[model samples]
Target: MIAIRLRSSCGAALVGVLALATSGCGLSAELDRETNPERKPTPSETRAVLPPVSATPSPSVSVQPVSGCPSSGLRFEVGRVDGAMGLRAMTLSMTNCGEQPYELNGYPSVSVLDEAGAPIPGVRTAEGTDEVPVAPPGSAPEPFTLKPGETARAGLLWRMAAEDGTYLRVAPDKKRDFVNVRPEEPLDIGPENILGTTPWAPAS
Candidate 1:
């Protein structure tokens, strides 16, 4: 079974429930019944025919940082919510692994998924918030620049219709898409301290 991590938000849960309606398992059964309801058993039905299987291996994923961020070694952690807020948020922890100081300007993107590995529509970034800044309150907040071997924390929030698949994604900015962070990397989201928990995992 596919289990998605969720918060107490009623809105996210409502979206999850609606997603269940379009799932494949039930739809497949319904299609079978509709197509062959009046057919009688044939000799072929009694014969066991094992289909040929291929030996090719499935693709494997490795946890890697987006290209330029490797030197910064930024890591993310997510928390559970109490209910669906028109907005969803998570905290990001960034560490500077390289000798040079790093400058962090924007927040990452977040995506919610369903059991079938499809992205839940209606989820987006909240209005008026470009990206949560790392600058402190009333700090005149010069651009956030972490020194060598320094660590900083920031919050990344998004506006989503609902929370589904126990999975969430934190991605880099659009111009930085070339950073190439692997989507399957384990995030420090609360409750399992596990990695590779993407919604795209094979169905149970």
Candidate 2:
């Protein structure tokens, strides 16, 4: 025969509660059910399965660096804007003659040329004004693209001094060779700087 004994205080109270459970208390049955709980579903319990994923290859793209335009295929054009207060406004335009696209930007190097094709001294470079807007206007330079037959522009500002010079020599920045240009319709750049240019931009 099995014999059970309870001591004083909490143990005795617990035994009294179990005696109530024998009289049909649900609390004891609920506790017993929780102690030996049913098993829950897990990932491996499901019969459905998904196959492993296969990676697909993506297409590749190659990028090319921009390059300066060749001087040989470029034709430069000068346009007259206005003349007031002794300052002349003009646009310097360059057209691409070749079949390929070329990249250029910033101010084109410029200098006054003498009768014998020599550069005149003492002519300094400065920023050109909007009276004759340059391509990619503003102080900074921007990358400009030119396709075949397309033109780019810069602003030209200078005073016409009979004693100064005859022709103008201009070239892409960092380029050794240059193009000789002469203003047909001269603007009376009276008291302004003797020479100036703006950063290059594509002509609209």
Task: Highest TM-score: give the candidate number.
Answer: 2
lDDT of all predictions, in order shown? 0.40, 0.56
> Where does candidate 2 stray beyond 4 Å?
1-71, 127-139, 159-163, 185-194
Query: Candidate 2 has which clashing residue pairs, if any?
Result: 86-189, 86-190, 88-189
lDDT of 1 by residue, 1-204 (tens): 112232334445677867886696689878878888976564545778886532222233223433455643544444343224343434444455667665555444554443333345544442123332321111112256667656654443333332233345454333443222222322222221111111111111
Model 1 weakest lDDT span, ten residues long = 194-203
lDDT of 2 at 118: 54
Candidate 2's error at 29, in angstroms?
99
Give me the overall lDDT of model 1: 0.40
Name the lDDT value of residue 123 in candidate 2. Answer: 58
lDDT of 1 at 119: 44
Cα deviation of 90 in candidate 2 (Å)? 1.6
Candidate 1 segments whose C-alpha is farther than 4 A from its true place: 1-72, 80-89, 114-118, 127-142, 157-162, 177-204
